[model samples]
Target: MHKLNGSFSTGYALLTGLMLIALAPASSAQESKEPDIVPAGETKTPKTRVLELGAKLLQSNSPLKRFDIYLVGFHPMKDSPEDQMEAHHYCHQVNEDFAQCALFDGNTADANLNGIEYIISEKLFASLPEEEKKYWHPHNGEILSGQLIAPGIPNMAEKSLMKGKMNSYGKTWHVWDTGHEGKLGTTLPLGEPMLGWSFSRDGEAIPGLVEKRDKKLKIDTSEVRKQREDLKQYAKPQSGVDDLKGKFSRPTRDIPGVIDQGNARSLPHTTE
Candidate 1:
């Protein structure tokens, strides 16, 4: 197991402070690319606002307060790879090996709560039944390709968090299709919940999906990927890496250190 270092503790403290300010009730200063369909309802009256204010002051929100880590990534519907969308994850580390995240379509205050994801370490995942393992997606590809990132924290803190999650897996279910980069999303969270999967190879994601996110967030995936090349030493052969291998519209290519568990013996764990 990869042990937690002091850097992780320092990062957690920084993240906690950021989350406190983020969770405060505030206006939507930043708008989401996919806006929620405004449901039919009457405008809030002064009486309603006052009542809400009282409830906010009196009601206990302790459970919601611990979701301090914020991450951004994209998910392709497991059954339909063509249907993909960006996901914003607000997570709480339940323990060293478990986490639960609330999924949103964007990072703004008005972002829609579209889904939920449960994350677990490789040790816990290994104990699951074979049938149940199919639902979870591997993390090495997402981490190594620089597609998954913690947006608001310092670079060192984010890297430490990602390193800790090198061999983890996530089971995600997106309950809504809030659209993609250029298109407008459904006004309502329609249809059955979609099981989300990771892009384990290059060119698997729809064209321009990752670029749009990088441009909007002002970060470079290439630089991030270079920074994480060293993390490949910790990579392990994981399940679900090849589940969608030939399913993408474009041709795909391998990323070093990411392979299916069936090919475990063929891959090297370290460069040396």
Candidate 2:
């Protein structure tokens, strides 16, 4: 036999290896399977499904409306000129021309009963005599002051919602003074409901209350104030306006009972 050259021997060995790879009993597809590929436009994860359901539920819930706001005022019988800041959570709904709100002392689930607020449409508010209007506070000041905030809402959405409430009037009465005592008293204080008002200016509210609230809610009241500058026209003018001038003791005819004198002096008044 002729002696094989090294080059030819190497070429034969390479060709044999290639043939073995091609002929290797094509491994059953089941033995080495590729990962299942999610077809284009057909992927849906558990998280996405959950988000869709949440959106649908939010759209279906119509009657329940909730907001967290701060009301500033004091006991009706107290003559001391001071500002009291009370945190309130309002769940209100409007049917026809009437609106009713359930008020809570704090914004959380553990919050206690503070009081209730009633609102009427502009037509209804207009029909009331001028004297009756004093008991109702204009919401424009509350809306524009950046003090009355609705938590868990986008800034633009909150502003749009407040626009609808601009002309609306609210008559709020506080049953519990949780700000002072720290807890809801065992029994509901017996007396006329203390009228609650909104902060109309920069210094009218408690110095740190608004700031603390803004921090907790991750909101900037200064930005809200800037956005509401155009709403000033809707606000009631301070000229001859007793309501914004620390004169909130007027008794409303809607709720029964005279102003209670004993509870007025229970808490020390803080000066404006």
Candidate 3:
């Protein structure tokens, strides 16, 4: 919906390019009440593009640039190959799966990057009890952990879910579930798993696994700003939002000639 390239008026910066490059289709039609529309095959207009950690993408255009930088640079020990592979799958899944409800959501990679921002903003912040403010403190390294926000699944490349319980005493607790088993009912439109952000019957910001959040769920704008700041380091300099939307509107099984050797380096199975 938003024009991605114009944001990078100064030319493709490395992080901006990476974020654009990372753009993927939305996982759902309306995620936390946002539009995710992008056209596929349209090359990104990057502000900056860089190849880091063998292969990782980030964006700097959004307001939450800091989160962009942090996400890519985090975990210097580096993620295991398995973790990396799973991460990619989850990201890819987020892109494709968003198409179920609406024609499409914004680029999933962008959305994925925003996922951190989303958690910190609307989900995590609002979820926090007014008294438990320390946990949301910026100094806590754990705040950066994808697990802290929604540990249901720790793969940014995959869809996230949240679960809750009805205690014996009629109380409730939080549970998270990440991992996609595909969508329900082949007959459904965009029959991918109920992945990504979708409201529950109760109107809560339910992760895919969780059944509900609240009626007025919305992504936190402040968190969105911070994540954008952090993610700038890994954000793609290119503007792939248009391409991402196009690809989602009329997707293909695979692009055929596009060989992702970089991704394959970390994920052997990704090789064409």
Candidate 4:
């Protein structure tokens, strides 16, 4: 009787072990198959497609007509009326034309049509004919593009003596200091670089330039509030991913995937 009991116990244990093994792979597979914008720890094609499409749109060949532009919560356009005015004043001081854009919410006053939440910049802004200029708010980059932080040029000394070199554009240009700017964003209107003005993450300055600025000298007022009573809300973090998914009509991924990889999956992150 003792021998029989031992055999039965061993048999039962073996059967249970086999059952777990049989089910393990399917469970793991299900978890892996959960909706992902990009494959876990892998590159996502949708991300690349969005970037490529954006580039194509920027190029003369894209068929995009009247894309609805949007701004984020903390940038110049997102500030209160007073802060918005300040940003405008500052942009004008530097000769930039950045403006505040917003949606057609019922609250938009006839006078406040200038404050729409989307800004049209680059060739898109310039593409409008002269008559359209009245309809299109002036983009500030034209005024802000040449702001300087350098000592006056020997032959030409003026307030525009940017001691640094132009690095990138964010509706405004970013000039990297020869290395003495304190508290980044000290000099000009480059609040955040939205458009790729050709500088690279590798710090390669265009193709022929090889000078390093001491520090970022521009005081990019991308998110400064001009008023005290205004509140701002950023579009959900997954907004970009959703936009891409919608554009392609592909399956959408969770917000975590979008945040973990900004357009690029497998980006190395720093921990504090």
Candidate 5:
């Protein structure tokens, strides 16, 4: 078990410096796939822009500065499995075992802030009450299947980060239904907040959901999955992996190393 120690901290500092330099230009590889959604609201005037610049220069944004890690993944509404959207997460690693993220519809400057997610280590998750477990979704499926990725980071750094997050769980809530993948969403945040869940099995995500994301982001999820094959050994059966089972119409295949808690039958042969 690798602890988040001095070496990791040094690496992260270096990585942050690299990212800052690399992203100095407008055309950054780390930029989100899509542009800002919906042509709603009036354009900003010179006065407004001046005021925003002043705030940026003078405001104490210490909390915002902590959000250095950028991750991208898809989340489906727990109640409505088909209601899925790509989530861009700007996260702060509060500690070795916990992280909090601000979820957005896109990664652009104009992206909509739609949700929030709290991540916890497996150890922390184990301490959670059994009845409360359903609120958290396992991360092994997302990590091993390569559905979740930290964009712009080196492979080694990303893998190290993902390895630390193995067996973790995240509780997410989407408060706004911003438009996604050409679908127009509510002009404003409407209705109650929706709980978000992970895609445990292959094909659970709606057709074209991952495809469109991969195409736009220039990522090959298959290759990323292959690269992460070694991380499977760290995975364990997690609660909520089967919560959405049989919900999708598509034929689903079991992702190796990702099984629901207590469902021995669903465990991959390799794992056993």
Candidate 6:
């Protein structure tokens, strides 16, 4: 685990203070109705404190920032409905259209790594072939339903930020299943990667878990739902990677724990 040196830095403390303010209820009624505004309460856990400090430090130096999103309707095997898992994502956005996220077993930061998700713009997604598209998922349900959220930003700013992400696609694979066992095992589980999907309909997410998340975060997802009504038309259908009707295997060329050399070639080369 990563540790912070000394006490929490002044910059982190200040950013946390601002986040608290930004998450509070406004004094005026007009301000309350603004989509960009939401409320937050005090921090509770050591892990959260660490994450806050880390997020502050990262945002100070780079364009990276974090958002928490909940996802369900997952199955490790194609035919097994009993193999579902619930996951929470801590996403660090690298830019407007690209983000790499770490997935956790639950809402808390201490939860073990369930998997990772890479999100990219529709343009990048369109560049992929039809077979490759099956491994990806759409963001419409996660966004319009208010399941995907940036916690600290004011509603308007978050709304504006999400506007760019509204049409984006995500490629995710689950490596851990906390539900089957009480805790994560010592080693990486050996199996084909499980493709993840978002809740496609009302009440698809576990109601109890959703309530717990809203209560813990002190933000009403229903309000977020209302605010994003206009963006619903932009929502992508449950096709391509979103289709879960058939038995799908992991891409033959996509190996776990190995970076794709072909894809890496597109990255900018740097020499010392």
lDDT of 5 at 210: 86
User: After aligning candidate 3 to the native by TM-score, how far in Å is the CA of 240 from where it should be?
Assistant: 3.1
lDDT of 5 by residue, 1-272 (tens): 32332322444565666555565431354645654466468888999999999999999999999998888999988998888899999999887678899998888777888999999877889999989988998888899999998876666667777777788899999988886445678868889999999999999888888888888777789999999998877677788999999998879999997978879555445523
Q: Top TM-score: which candidate number?
A: 5
Residue 81 displacement in candidate 3 (angstroms):
35
lDDT of 4: 0.23
So what's the TM-score on candidate 1?
0.86
Q: What TM-score would every model get versus the actual structure?
A: 0.86, 0.55, 0.17, 0.16, 0.87, 0.56
Candidate 5, lDDT over the whole model? 0.81
Candidate 1's error at 52, in angstroms? 1.7
Candidate 6 regions exceeding 4 Å error are 1-86, 106-109, 180-191, 236-272
TM-score result, candidate 5: 0.87
* Deviating ranges (above 4 Å) for candidate 4: 1-115, 141-272
Clashes per candidate (backbone, < 3 Å): 0, 0, 91, 34, 0, 6
Candidate 1 residue 77 C-alpha distance from true site, Å: 0.5
Candidate 3, residues 192-271, lDDT tens digits: the string is 22212211011111133211111212223235234433322222211111121221222223221212223334433321
Error in Å for residue 263 of model 2:
34
Q: What is the lDDT of residue 120 in candidate 3?
A: 27
**In candidate 1, what are the lDDT values of residues 52-138, reduced to their tens digit?**
999999999899998877788999889988888889999998877788999998776667888999999888999999999999999
Off by over 4 Å in 1: 1-42, 181-183, 267-272
Ranked by TM-score from best down, the candidates are 5, 1, 6, 2, 3, 4
Error of 5 at 117 (Å): 0.5
Clashing pairs in 5: none
